[model samples]
Target: MAASSTTLTLRERWTRFVDEEMSTFVFSTGVYAAAICAKEYKELQPTPQRMQQALRKTGAKMPLITLSCAIGIAGMKMCILGVSRLREDYTRSSVLVACPVAGALLRAHRGPRAMAIGALSFGALGYGSDYLFSMWHRRNADAEEVRYALSLREHHNVHHNDAFFIETLQSNAYLLEASQK
Candidate 1:
């Protein structure tokens, strides 16, 4: 029995590692491919370059854009992590509270145009991803076979603050504080 349990754990960990690696690879590849395609299509405005020239210029921008996107995403995630640590029982709604503050700071450093674009993209990316994850989990939870198995799944520690998803981040400013009961 002990040997079987140990083998199960090893298999679970290997599955997780493979899944993570595949997802990372797919995401990076898709982002780079999209960026390259967009740039080539944009440059086609100038008398439609030969296929060779377009292909040559295409890959050059992809790497840079991919790196920039990775950095931006990492920075945003870091900020979200920081905010959750600062507040108790942080939720997705709580993160929205920091959007305006971020916008203001960005506006001051950049400009209104940048702030507007950044705010829209940030809001969409953050909330959309959260919603998608929730939907995936909900689907799993609703499955007859998964319900029983879920209990055996490992859960991450919630020592600092328990983060949850809410439909909107624009909930009342005092909501977190008032929800202690």
Candidate 2:
């Protein structure tokens, strides 16, 4: 969800776009496929005729599932991307905006109430996910910074007499202390 940067080559952008879209679509398809399998197993017998009918039903549904998943996932991602770009940063608000659009698309056929419920549910999920992810990233970054600082301190200790190394270590320590505050 990083903002698209000017440094990204056209090829890199295209690759990222394809990778994100395809992965989401594949995941959606897999979930739907599993749901279909469960439904078939629960409702039908194992007889050859029943199995054949199930197979036909599966075959007919697969294409629609694939197409709908691909389109739906792509639409959601595109909306998120657009919102992120417009906001000039990847934030929970961007996801908050995008999820309602996706929810409306998903539940529009059900009626306004369904759409509103879907939008509220999806928006809450998206916002919570974004918040949790950001928290995780922040924690990881802090740990990494601490690790780097420790490594630098170890190096400085080994080169105890090196003024520049000692000075650099002290500066890093000061920065770390400031950050913790």
Candidate 3:
């Protein structure tokens, strides 16, 4: 049982790692391709030869962009996971710990000032994203719980007014708060 559970955890972690890596790769590639197309549109002559050059340039650059994104995101995920393991909990703190390191690495080639800016920017983004996601999940869970309780109450009543019951559920404070966006 212990062995199986350990294997399951390892598998899940590997899945998460690969998922992040692949998603980052795909997203970066698409964005880069779009940027390349836009640049070609603005700068290149509208000729078959120019179009071919644009295609060739995109093909040449895509692998580099894809690899960079995949490796960078993978490294960031590893840092987050390592922090979570050390802290014995997965929380926003893990993102806070990882984002700066990832950001620093991202701008290291540009020297100290750029690296500092990147770290600060990435840290802020990570903090904001984590906070928003946590709040969103909490609201969703609260709304779901309210719905379940209301449903159970509905099932127990023999002569309840359907319209009134629905109105009551809709007016629930949790649901109201959740609905506020």
Winning model by TM-score: 3
> How well is each residue in 42-113 modelled by candidate 3, as lDDT tens digits?
344668777787777778767655654555566687898899999999986787889987776655555789
Which regions of candidate 3 deviate over 4 angstroms? 1-71, 74-78, 89-92, 158-175, 178-181
Q: How close is candidate 3 to the true structure, as a TM-score?
A: 0.54
lDDT of 2 by residue, 36-108 (tens): 7656753456577666776677777787667656655666778888988888899767767888777655555
RMSD of each: 16.3, 8.8, 6.8
Give the whole-model CA lDDT for all candidates, comma-separated: 0.53, 0.71, 0.72
How do the predictions measure up, each by TM-score?
Answer: 0.40, 0.51, 0.54
- Give stretches of model 2 more than 4 Å off: 1-23, 36-71, 74-78, 81-96, 158-181
| lDDT of prediction 1 | 0.53
Best by lDDT: 3
Which clashing pairs does model 1 show? none
Task: Please provide, for model 1 over 1-181, each residue's C-alpha lDDT reduced to its tens digit, 9 standing for 90 to 100.
Answer: 4666446587786687566554654575576566566656644455455455656776765565555444444444456667888876678765764554443333333467776776776677667877888876655544533333233232543334323212112232233323322
Look at candidate 1 and tell me the lDDT of residue 140.
Answer: 51
**Which of candidates 1 and 3 reaches a greater lDDT?**
3
